[model samples]
Target chain A: MKRKISLNPVTRLEGHGKIEIFLDQQGNVANAYLQVPELRGFEKFCEGRPAEEMARIMPRICGVCPEAHHLASVKALDALWQVEPPRPAKLLREIMCCAHFIHSHTAHFYVLAAPDFLLGPDADPARRNILGVVGKVGLETGREILKHRRYAQDIQAIIGGKATHPVTGLPGGLSKGITPGEREEILSKGKSCVEFARASLQIFEDAVLQNKRYLDLITGDVYRLESYSMGLVDDSNRLSFYDGNIRVVDQEGREFAKFAPGDYLQHVAERVEEWTYVKFPYLKNVGWRGFTDGKTSGIYRCGPLARINVTEGMATPAAREAYEKMVDTFGGKPIQATLAYHWARLVELLYAAERLVELAEDDAVLDPNVRALPTAEPGEGVGVVEAPRGTLIHHYRADREGMITGVNLIVGTTGNHAAINLSIRRAAEKLIRNGKVSRELLNMVEMVFRAYDPCLACATHSLPGRTPLEIKIYDSRGNLQERLWQ
Target chain B: MAVKKVVIGLGNPILSDDGFGIFAAREVECRLPAGAPVDVVEASLAGLKLLDFLLGYREAVIIDSVKTGSGRVGEIYCFTPEALRETVRLASVHDLNLATTLELGRMLNLPVPEQVTIFAVEVADNTTFGEGCCREVAAAIPQVAEQVLVHLGIESATG
Candidate 1:
């Protein structure tokens, strides 16, 4: 007899997804599949639009990380135009990106991921959320997190002209420049943000590290090692969020390759499966590896863990120190632990804040000329930026008349397709083999979903529904035996 | 001379009819006399940030796209601040809509024009990735522009 279990409408993440686990006659897990059911045809729709319009159109990909798309689109256009923006413009764009990182990562850690950490695995389903965290951890921390998010948005709004989708970033430079008064205000806030980030990090450390039971609750038998990792790496092999070479590292933290962003297509190939609209992107050399045991390796993880593994160190002093501490405490190797994503995110938050302060104090930031005057030149260009979730690349080709001829976008979440599916499968196998499915286990599977911090809505357009776990049993001949559909 | 009226267009042009406000603003700007008291500004949705332009004006007209089901594509809905509050749903946090923005402005105790009119064009294709307006909505542009001119007490060519 064969059995199948389906987890439909996966929750606690940005968009909709489903997981299916197949069981053989022996009641053992055979194959597990995870599917994200949304379709966002940004690349197809971008075809035949003006290259300059990419800056405006691409940001609509995600309301959460619009700044990332904006920056990447502008960079691609810059490459096409063969013009580097003024120093002030670059600094302003970087600052805006850092601010976006702080807010986005904080939201993920506190509001989305913290409930799993603080509420314990067996905590009530109803009470396992931000509100529940507030009840257990106190109102001050929750309020502080909210304040940090708002402050980050406000800073981005000042520079980019809006928080969600800022239109200020243009191809050659910014549509509007910041005043000295605005610079002073941003700097002061940047200083306070550093203190806030440090305090938040301390809270997470005390909660997760200092408390042995809490650590055991969240970590025991959760994380698994199976695939290689990818992220942005600076020339010095340090973790970098902005412009850098693409680094792919194996499970043991060995560098696979560091290639330019434009070379991504040569290495990455996307395969479409019948289960979902989200494409399975993998290292072309690995071939068609499925989620489970297969010669054709498929799903792999990206985002924070992959980023940290691929890079040797962090760029900012505070983040680098935190990274060292995390490694030392977690056995000094590439952490396969999904729970550590929160720790890595907080570290990046600190780095972003520190970097923001440094950039704000620079004299070039106050320069009156923040834009480079450039006429429309027709050509092909590529732009890459590291969004909060992962790498985002934009490619555009324009005609001699400056009209767009082609557009190809490789968003951050698409890069993590294989890993997310694999994580879901592993979690499902563990729960099904034990013959028990608790809400906590469901949440754990959801945690893997959260670990990738996927923006499914941005990746694809799909309908929303309830997330339920179902299972079925079958024989070797694909004969249905027993089933549990919930 | 008639009271100078300013019209502002809001929303992303790439998001199809989300650029309705901007389209109407541009059309109204082109129809008015060169030295007319009306100015048109193109802005992304900024809820409170719009106050900088609205202040010190005697009258201002705002043209935006409406998702309401009460009318057809070219159907025009006119409302004052008080009347708009009752009919339109103010769910957006961005200052993209004139109704909620005016309400926020009043709450912030900022200077606001005494006469404010809003022209909302019903939208059917707000999610498509393109710049030009749809055929139905595109046809309504001239009428919407004329309505704004008439509201501002200016002699429009159509009128």
Candidate 2:
């Protein structure tokens, strides 16, 4: 008899992604899949709108990472009109982008990921949350976090016009330039961010790394996957959030391909599976080798760990040190431990904070000239940016009058769809055995997905505000055995 | 110190009926008499992002779209933060719902509004991508805005 175990945690107005486990006659796990809800007709929805509206509209697609979408859309606009923004605008954009990184990465670590480690993974389900984290880490830390989060938002709001859904993007430049007072304030906030970032790393070192069990779990084989990695790199191959060529590295950490965003189609292809709404993006040259990993397989990972793995080092001094420490601790290059995503996220956070300060102090940040009138005809363009999750790609083709004709976007989370499925399956296989499923075991499975911080159905901002998961286990005789709701 | 009140409209404006909250907030903002002690703002964000806007206010009236799985197309319900605390569980993805965000604000000793009320409208459409709410939801916007004004003890000038 074949039994299927399904996990569907559906929430009102929010998107639903599920996991299903198939059991064979022996009552052993055979295959598992991560299924996300279908958000239909996004490209069809964009046809005939002014291409420039994408910067404003795309941000609404995902309330969580709107800044990432805004930056990517603006970059695509820059490419579409073939205009280069002045130096001040470029620096200003990068500063805001870095601030966005800080806000997102910090929130993910403290609120979502930290509770698992700090409150103990097997802690009471009721207390295993941000409240639990705040309880243990102290309320002062929470205050500091809130303060820095506000600082990041203030920076973004000052630059992008709003915190969540921004409106400052244009074809050649921002709608406005920074003032001297704003620069001074941003620089001061940036310094404070740097301090907070360092303290965050210290907290991780003390709370997570010092604990033997958590450290072991982080580097353990259950969460490990040997796969290629991809991220954005500047001219010197340093990890860069904005303005860089796309870089891909093999499992051994050798550079595989580095190409401009316009050539993305030639290097990458999306594989649509009948099981899920999310598409699996894979390298075209290596081809799609199923859901498996390794050099021969096209399944590569993105986000913090993948970004760290693919780059030479962080550009900023403090971040470079943090990167070296992490690389050394992990025993070398190509750290396949998926849980290290949290650690790599911290390193990136430090880099972003440092970069924010560096850019604020630069003289050109106060330049009066920000926009250069775009003169090029509307055509096809591609914009790539390293979002908090991973590489965010926005491609658009517009008519001569600048109306959008076609749109294709490979969001950061979608890039890791195949890898996420593989990770879920690997965790399920190891934790679920003999047709038994426990809450603890299920959480372990969830930890794998949580590490990716996958944001399917991200664009919508409905009320009650959360994604839900429901898990149902069936016995080998096709009888329902257990159900877990979260 | 005199208390300040803010009415936050929450939801995406482009996602059909999901925009009711925003529209309602705008209605409240437009119809309020001059020198009213209330400020109206719109945000397409949730969780901690929502808390950022609610900070420094003594009271917050949140207007947003809600789906309860029942067949009410445009019915509106009022709720307190305490009432929501019981139902808002920690999400598997994304940190903090409304209840937790407020809870954390208090725990951190932030000036979270002492009184928090949520005005949720049951809507028919939230997934469809378009501007403006569906007719049923759009009809409730003015009623909801007037209700918010009355809740604040401020008489509507337009009425």
Candidate 3:
């Protein structure tokens, strides 16, 4: 019998997602799909509001990357009014951006990605979490994770105004500057964070890279995606999270395109799929050729792995050294293994931590002058940033009165939508053999999907706390076979 | 001496009825007597993120929106941490669920609250992006808040 298996509420992901696998009559996996929910009408809701309000409202979309939204929105406001922020203000904003990356990437690597690598994907669902990771690693490691997360959060709250939605960004500059006392506190935390990030990478080396089987899982074909990589980089092609020119590299590690944020519409395009509410973002010049991953398909990826592939190297010394070692281990440029995203994320964590320290120690951080008032007529603008998950784009248009008439946001997670689906489909096809289905098998399939660290906060806004996860299986005849709750 | 108790509201204020907690938290703040023994915090996070809000409190109350599917719109349901533990759909999503977060806090030897209470307001809509809640959920905000007040052993300001 040709049967279908539905895994709704794909567990452990930040927002709602589901996967369905269809098996052939021979019982081998035939096809699979990933469906992501939609929050609906964010653009329409932004309409008719004042332009300046976006910086405050945009962060409400996702709890995981609110700082990303806050920074991007304010940058858009800056572009809309044709104003440049002062050096101190830019430093202040970048400091917060660094903290945001450390906070967000730390959570993804520890809470969502590490459990599988540390505890083994086939481990009991109850034990395959941070708790289990703690149990294996020890109490000290758990406290370290919590402590670093707290440090990042504290830095964000200090610069952004609050831990959730920061109120620090103004049109041309920040609302306020930090005091010397605050700088000392932030500098101390930033120094410790650099060490923490270094330890995190070592943890990965000890657990996954040191183990042959785990290393195979990371570099294996089942989790590999040979596609175009997109990221933001500075003049030296160094990975820059806050602001830079958008650069992309093809599967063969060739520079495909590089353009400024204002010209993004010339490079990126979106495709709608019938199965999911989330839109698939692909390279505009390459053209959309469906979910297939190749130089011709136009489907591209952004985020840690893709960012590393697109850039020359890290901006900091420690991260740069680690980055070179990772590239060397993979046999050179453009590591295509999807699971390597976990490794790339750690490299960026260290860079952000080091960057945090650099900014905190700068004399400009304590400058009293922070604002450059906007004087130009506000009409239209686009702002882009490399959020922890991936590249985020915030486009807005307003009238002369500064009232926003329209808005469009291409969030970080959405950039990897096509890649996530392709990875899941490939894993499902390989893992599910003739007439074989078990919890361990399903979890293995999930392990491939989790490598992307997909955050669906942009797509799902529903209260997810109380909904019960249910999985159902049905035969070709449309009769239900079994139902299981996780 | 100030009370070592705090009230925390969790949800996205722009997501239709999901803003119930933020709205109710504001109402609770206004209704409390001058120098009330409790501090009210409105946050839009869950899992380990809540640990920051729960640290140092002897007792804590969490008010958030929920969609049980079986519950009526605007119905205020009092739930223990154990009940939420059973109903958690996304086991490891954005952060740890409340039960796991608290347990982790205790294991980490953090000063997490000893007594925790969760009050969920059944929601009518949570996906739409709007600052205001739907009419039904908005009506229940005051009543659910009153229930929280009663649980906290405070008299209603209406009296």
* DockQ values of all predictions: 0.06, 0.44, 0.59
Model 3 whole-model lDDT (C-alpha atoms) = 0.86
* Candidate 3 chain A, poorest ten consecutive residues by summed lDDT: A459-468
Candidate 1, Cα interface RMSD: 9.5
lDDT score, candidate 1, position B29? 78
lDDT of 2: 0.86
Find the candidate with the highest lDDT and give its number: 3
lDDT of 1 at A380: 78
Q: Name the top DockQ candidate.
A: 3
CAPRI band of model 3? Answer: medium
The local distance difference test score of each candidate is 0.70, 0.86, 0.86
Q: Order of all candidates by lDDT, from best down to worst?
A: 3, 2, 1
Candidate 2 DockQ vs. native: 0.44
Residue-level lDDT of model 3, residues A105-196, one tens digit each, is 89888888998999888777778788888888889989999999999999999999887789989899999889899899899999999999
TM-score of 3: 0.97
TM-score of each: 0.75, 0.96, 0.97
Task: Give the TM-score of chain B in candidate 2.
Answer: 0.95
Runs in model 1 lying further than 4 Å from the true structure: A217-221, A292-300, A459-486, B1-159
True contacts kept of 1: 0.01
